[model samples]
Target: MAAVKLSGKSILALLLMYVVLIFVLQMWVGPRDRWAGYSVLTPLVAAALLPFRRTLLVGAFTLLAITGSYGFGVTGLSVGARFVVIMATALSFGISLIVCRVRLEREERVKRLMVARDRLSLLSAASSRVGGTLDVTSTARELAEVAALRFADSVTVDLFEPVLRGEDPQDLPADGCVTLRRAAHVTAVAATGRETTALRANSAGAGQNREVHVPARWLDPGRPAATRVLEGGEIGASGLPMPLPSAGTGAEGWVTAIAVPLTAGKATLGLAVFARGPGRAPFDADDLMLAEEIAMRAGVCVDNARRYTRERETSLTLQQSLLPDRPPEQQAADVATRYIPAGSQAGVGGDWFDVIPLSGARVALVVGDVVGHGVQASATMGRLRSAVRTLADIDLPPDELLTHLDDIVVKLSAESLGDHGTTPRGDIGATCLYAVYDPVSRDCTLASAGHPVPALRTPDGVCEFVDLPPGPPLGLGGLPFESVTLSLPEDSLIALYSDGLVESRHRDIDAGFKELKQVLAQHAGALEATCDNTLKVLVDDPPQDDVAVLLACTRALDASQVAVWEFARDPAVVSQAREAVSRQLSRWGLEGAVLTTELVVSELVTNAIRYGSGPVQLRLIRQKTLICEVSDGCNTAPHLRRARTYDEGGRGLFIIANVTERWGTRQSRRGKTIWTEQALAP
Candidate 1:
């Protein structure tokens, strides 16, 4: 309805009906009787209509009608009639004034409740939405979107890191519709506990920008506080100035802003702000309070998510670095090494095993487990492994090498023990095994320090753990370790494993070893396949701990299959070797490579007779690769160097080096073997 028309018509119509009603009432009912009832009814009706202007107007008209007709327009009236009319009008006006006051209070209360509900709802949503997220950037984006949807017309988030001083501000997203760098905004919010905003007019006109600063009235700058405040720690309040309808331009265009502090555990994490241009609806105290609640919950969720993300990233990187792109190729006796970290932690570990070539025709085999996992364990494993190689190069016996390692551990523990003062036992301790094997003699010597015994699986499918005296664990001294010697029969397979393979929580060490033996027995025959199958049995699915396994087999060529020809220091020796090669070549029915072998054999025998030792032995074997070995008591090893045009003596080694596809020298305590290999006939 038009305000002017409704007001004028309502007043005129009301006045006209007032006269008519009073006149009729006075004539029909005695004025003396009506005064008391009219007096009571007028003020009661006026008071009932304290909230609505329409109710007030209608009630006033009714009162005037009754009073005017009964007191003035009627044929006869008593003294009480005038008193009733005057008192009724006065009471109606007084009630109308009181109603106006009450209406204002009710409106304010409703606005406050709505604002409070909005703030509460926003906080509740933020808590539930971001609590478990593991990515910080994604969480920031989510918070920004939630803030925009809940509080203001638009929202943006920028992460400010003061420690990272070299960052570019332009790269950051705009925050809360304000044109401020993210780093700058973070500084501002942190310093003042306030949010900056650009005012928006309405939901449709929210695009307009009007820069404004909110006061940090809720925070005390001098008081020390944590980064977050716990829920219910602080009460929140908000206020927004109302604009007059008739006010124009600058004076009337006052913007409204609301703020809620995001707090957890007595500290504020951040702040959320809502704002709009002039002519927008004003915010109530409850809005700011509700915002604070939402902020508090959001703060906790963000912190958790960030921590989770950091740990996940670090673990992933460490795991990748620990794992090799591919395992080492098949070594002596067809060895394959497969390493898998515990899937749960995704961290690097110190579990390692290796098949290292020794000075003689032996392999120095080892498998060890460090006390822990992750970056520290990985680094320690690297150091220990290097030490093992160094000790091996020095020709230290297995037992002596282990003793040296124990000494190193003792020193390391003593030096670093003070760092771990909180723990009763400081620093990590390791378990290790060192073994040396000679394929020729089929002899294996092993030493252990608190490590599980290596198992031997014979060609006939018999499996048994090696029996050895237990020694003290590394880093702790109680008893000295002694080497154990075992005859590894030809075609026998030996397996070394870390305790993680068989040691389950429910079983003791002996039971674990028994389990390993049972697993080996189940998968016998194929050495490589059995090793893999045994590992699978011991590991099962979802292994609770880390596992490392190394397996090797001994193969000895029979005397009939391998022929050795010995010669003395004489020209006849070279002729003898040539005749022997020719006879073998003819017997084997070989022709093309046979001449090359004879020439190589004659030249090697000539050199051995001329410049070398007490005795020389030439052995030929029909194996996977053609094996031709020359052994001499001379400790001096022969080298094939780049021969000059005038060089004659080094030509023998040069020819041998060229003919051999694969060759190596092994120095033993007694003598050294210079073995050269030719590819087998198809």
Candidate 2:
């Protein structure tokens, strides 16, 4: 039960009543041991009704009264009664004092329990709300916000510079000097209404998570307690003029603050600062413990985020290095491309595109997506992109190139199974669209491996998707890929893209395609602008998956730039072809190439006639280079063997090889075409 508290008037009345009672006991009930002990009654009453101090003062008064009665003889008192009064008054005072102390101790214990419960609530809030994501800045902001709400007036979380970028933080050195980036700073000033508190949001330094490197001495800014804490010491509290958040206002200084290390096991990732301004209660031991627990939780979260950041950075670096920043310049098409990586939460994705130059003034347009996210998918994308380039170098047709690519993916999946027992996507699945556009023929032969079809924009500005058949994606074995050959008009645009460009969470794939078609048809500009507009109109910000788009405009070789001739399998045609090539080169204003062209034409034509069967065909094309192609109906392949001193036949190909910039044979269903290119003057 609570002790009774008397009013000031009531306390005085009690004192007067004690005096009156003493008078009665000494004057009327004189010399009686029972009446003499009545002095004890006043102090006991005061103890029950008054505070400890009041009870003691009243007890002192009672003893003085008892002494006066015995010494002055106002009422004759027995020595025993006098002893009784002294003993009773002394015992009353002692009992009142002990009860008061016990009450005070109990109240203090209750207060501690209340504080413990609040801290527990704060810790619970931190766990549930803070570090809700694997993003470094986001988790730090969460920690600061959660702590500022209930525990401290202002909160700041500063982490090592590398930790913000998702890398491991170095340990605090012996000198305790290191630079840190301010991740989050949140301050809430107290308001009159507890229900509606004014929260002031502020970002650290100039911007959020800006890693501004300064002298290490500035970390604590003359705050000795914070410096010690940063030097691997325990949590420390101090009063110092700490810097406020960049946007902080209405609050200039802090009265007290505590700095706790953000630690995961023995590793210190950063520090969290919690402070109170004037009129707010200073942090005590309980608040420090609470801050430490929250910091520990934040540290683990930050470490997890850091790990993810590091992995993502590695993957992105690899992806960037593997992907082409700009397509290599080629004669077949004008090229432009755009690539945007996926958001941080969803992890990195594998989307890649390329414009690879092929032989015979041909260009290969490619876009592919590995069927997953993260470093594995990105690595897989690199491998697939490289494979496509290698196969394209052999002048493989679209269907054949994808077939080879699919085989590679299957082999990769098998390798993954051998190494890790399973691939990330069950079998290293990926989708690709490979289109080879030959400017000489004005034909684009394209094949899709479970990838989106290209949207073709003709010269007249009509846009539509070529409803070509799509084969199974790479990694699916035993699937035949079909290629569709379409003749593109000069300056026709083919937009090849990964699925991410036309896929999103909020819309169906068909809707995305429709929107993309409209955007392409409605917008007209440079190839670069078209790429930008395509992404802007069709894709959401921070795209759900990696996005890659390649836009290429086709160009054709004019009839005047090309020459062709057919002849019976005879050596006489070699000279006739050489004369005709001279005439064509003159007409094309390329008389300068006549000597090399005739030599290449004579050797390639002669070789086709000697070893090959059926009629022979010779063609010359002028673009960036002079191309001489000789086709014959022969299944046998030729090798460039060194001629003996007296050899008559092998010198023909050896001479052609030495005179030409590059020469190769392209095998065909009919027979084979041996082609050679000579550099043209710029």
Candidate 3:
């Protein structure tokens, strides 16, 4: 059976009853009787139920009562019986004292065990709470909260500046001073029902509001106690002399504080302080040990969080640098673009877009997506963008350009596999859409490699996706890509985007496309405003995938700015072509370029007639630059070469190249068109 505890009042009542019973017994029998000494039971009950001091008082009272009974001559007896009673009474009193001592020892031992159990529970809770996040500030705040609730009236967490920034912890300050930044501070309500303000101090020369400089004397390594705590990773206690005088009114009851070094491995991250108020009990050795355990657990978590933050910042910086600051301005199109990275957990991704200016007043609108996230994906995106720009410089057709890109991706994948015996992640697969828009023809030729089709919005606000062929994604060799050309009306809007804009876990590709078209149709304004609205409507907050959107509005050259002519494969038509070019230049007010234009036209027409097929044609365009074009049913590309002294034919193109800003040939559906651009007169 469990022991029943008696209160002090109950013990006193029981002792009084025993005294009266002893008197009654002496009156009934005699004070010299053998049972008379049984009065000792009064003090023994007191020892079991009352405190030590109260038990001794009860014993003395019982002894005096016995003496009074005997002195009153309540029982007539010889000196021998009296001596026996007195001896028994003294022995009983000695036994009661022993019982009181044993009871006090057991109570003390039980109290210590309870305190230890409570501390262990608090530490367990702290561990579970502090390490849940990989954010340094969050971890520090959690530690402060746990300590303030369980360990002390107030708690403050301060970390070394470098440690907070994820850098290696430096040695203590050279001048024997330490700089620490306060990460979190929490104080309990005072007895007067008011909140206490925490102390704040800025580090000398640091200028940061949250940081403070601790003097060398306070943390002197030479002191045995300081060394034991700083070097040995133990917890130490100190008195704070009201660091905040103004706030001291509310914290008037605060007195002592315990400091625990937040050490992880061999490096000390910072310190955690737990303070007690006047009404609250001062921390004992056991409390200091508990604080140390909590700080140790928090230190490791804070370090991990800081490292993660640093890496995330680095990856984001690298990705942003790789993206274009702004799309290049071109006469072919007005461009606007938007790029948004995925959520933090998803890290940086490989989605990218660019507006590349090509020869012949054409612009290549590109959008691409690598398969994965992080630095590797971003690096791959950069490499692919560079490759695209290189290939675009050669003026390859859209389909052929993607073919070269596919080969590059395939080689990269193979090399990665060769190095590791397995394909490297984030380096292999990607999807891309390439589109070229020419303002002179108001035509856009586009091709895709496992990429989403682009949306086109006519000037009248009608939006629809272009039905271009989809080829296999890059790195998957052997698949051929096809290009489709569509003539856009002047001021028509063309949208190129990565799949992240149209596809997510909750939304399907078709629904995203529908929403995209709806948003574009509703907004009828400048391309920049349209781009902003598209992003606002289609992209969710912290998008699940990297998003890239490129919007361009086509501007076509007017018919008055263009002239075309057809000629037979006859030598005499060269003169007619020259006269036609001169008349066009005269009508267009390009009198300064007339002489150069006529010579260039005569040379190009004669070459076409002699070396090219019949039914040849010539076209002139007046735009940002003066363009001269000659076309025929010829598939062969023209090459420039130096002529020996005997070669009169080679100098024709050489002279044209020198007179024009740039010259190139583009393959058309029927044949090829060799063209040159000259700077227009100011």
Candidate 4:
């Protein structure tokens, strides 16, 4: 009867014992008297051993001998007794076998379901552990605990290079009924190829299982196994799991360690280990499965952390590189500048302003904005800024400069289009304003390329935008640009800005302009202060796009206070030129600064007279400073050169460059005007 609940050998031995029991029962009992009862019990005995089919066969034969006693007893009696006893025994055996087999099959199926549920529970717990900590060490320890509870007799987590190890490196509490061991065991695993090990309670303590060494590479064969050893240790790869070699303190025990490789991709991030007692059963398929999942989750989190670190570094570098290191030099006027990048974590867009000096005492002031953001936008801004500075210095008019810029953009589009297998037309465009100012003549010339018109403020504080029809944006329609001329009053200011300042998502262009005018009216005390306050009022937050502004205010000289002198034309004109200018300044109440004024005027007027066959006019004005303007009928522009030491005539412009704060020439329909300006004594 016990055979049904026993192993194969136990059932066989039980059958032999049953045979002896039957022989005793038969010999001691009176055959005829108990024959019918023994016959009925024969089938019951067979049924008891049915679950162990091989032993059941032996037991059935043993029972048959005992049943024969019943038949023998019945043979000694009447024919009716024998027939009843044999038939009843046979029927009982058949029914018992069927019932026992059915029950055993049901038990096996239930066992399988229990095993599957245990595995699912382990996986769910591991997933929860992943969410609690961003640090890899704590995550790894939690994962180990999950593994031990679900799969092994005990879990020994040997982290080679624990990616999840947090900064503090604290100990992870063991899972229920699990023994925790945190050690760098990757090298031993790689060299030995094991994930877990068991130690005997007496040998290393005693009552331990054999150690099994499992190589991390066993999970995914594609990853190289050897490189996973930890540094400065004999361990292979960065981390690996190693099973204990044996159950004893000595090295002679059964294999007990299993190693699990922790990795996101190719590199071994760390390892997990499982160990079983030497006499206990080896780890099953479910244990191996649980370890694999833990490693995979850990790998993903480590990869994310590394990626985040790299991106942050790159963004910081890019933003710093895009900003200017120092303010631009003031060539013709006092200048102040400030640049604020897009305040987001990524980067700033392309917004830049530059002031470049042109020949003949004119300065080109430029402000521009490139579209887009991040690395690409920063690069494009650099290119456009350099181009504008170059083109401006080459004496190109504002319209021509914009046209050349447009050509550059078109060329860039043609070259870069479809470069990445996608045609990106009209994806790039820039808004820029170029203004050329002659301090000497107090004339400001401007050209806009799909850019905002500058607001002009008179010396008396009257502010208005230069009323001109807007031209097409660069890289749009290739239209000819019209250069606008404005008579600049001394000490007046001109403000140029990118559209970002005057165009908002919530308002139209007209409204933005109105707002800009209001800001100027409220903060129009000083050039630098006005620009700073106006920008602060307009932009309370970082602009959604790039913004650039350039402000210039004239330091008008007073013409009424300028000295005047009349002289007769003389053959030796150099002395007369100097005398006429000096005497005029002395008469006009500027005797203290007459030397500088006289010297510049003499050179300019003398050059006009010597180089031309027409009349020339010399005039001086003083506003915030003194200015000397000489007009001649010749339309040819003057050249400033490093004159040879013996060349007396060519030193005129060179001398002017050293003496005045600024100077320039204006070519009008009448002829050309050359002028120089000097700062007044405070």
Candidate 2 local lDDT, 1-682, one digit each (tens): 9999769568858676867676666666635455555666676666656666776677777777766666465545566756666677678767766765666577779988988888888888888987777898889988987887477776778889878877778755545456677788776644445412344335443445644343343333233432423211222222222535532333556666777777776667777777766656767665666777888888898998889999999989989999997789888999989889988877888899998977677888999999888899889999998899888877888898899998999899887765466434445889999998888789999999999999998888799999899899898889899999999999888899988888999999999989988877864658888888889888888788889999998888877777789988878888999999998888888889999888888888887898899999988877778888989999777888899999766787788888889888777779988888898889
Off by over 4 Å in 1: 1-338, 343-347, 356-364, 382-430, 436-440, 459-461, 469-483, 526-544, 553-561, 569-571, 585-590, 638-655, 680-682
The collision pairs in model 2 are none
RMSD of each: 13.3, 6.9, 6.3, 13.8
**CA lDDT of every candidate:** 0.59, 0.78, 0.78, 0.60
Candidate 4, superposed: residue stretches over 4 Å from native = 1-337, 343-346, 356-364, 394-397, 411-428, 436-444, 454-466, 486-495, 502-518, 524-543, 550-555, 560-574, 584-606, 617-631, 637-682
Candidate 4: residue 631 Cα off by (Å): 4.3
Question: What's the lDDT for residue 32 in model 3?
Answer: 42
TM-score for each candidate, following the candidate numbering: 0.51, 0.80, 0.77, 0.49
- How does candidate 1 fare on TM-score? 0.51
> Model 4, residue 518: displacement in angstroms?
4.7
Model 3 stretches with alpha carbons more than 4 Å out: 1-128, 131-133, 159-171, 188-209, 216-250, 260-271, 284-290, 418-427, 466-470, 502-515, 538-540, 642-649, 652-654
lDDT for each residue of candidate 1 in 527-598, tens digit (9 for 90 to 100): 668767777766745455678888777656455455678887777778788888777766766666677788
Alpha carbon lDDT at 640, candidate 4: 87
**lDDT (Cα, tens digit) per residue for candidate 3, span 520-582:** 887676778888888888888878899999998888877898899999999999999989988
Q: How far is candidate 3 from the true structure (C-alpha RMSD, Å)?
A: 6.3
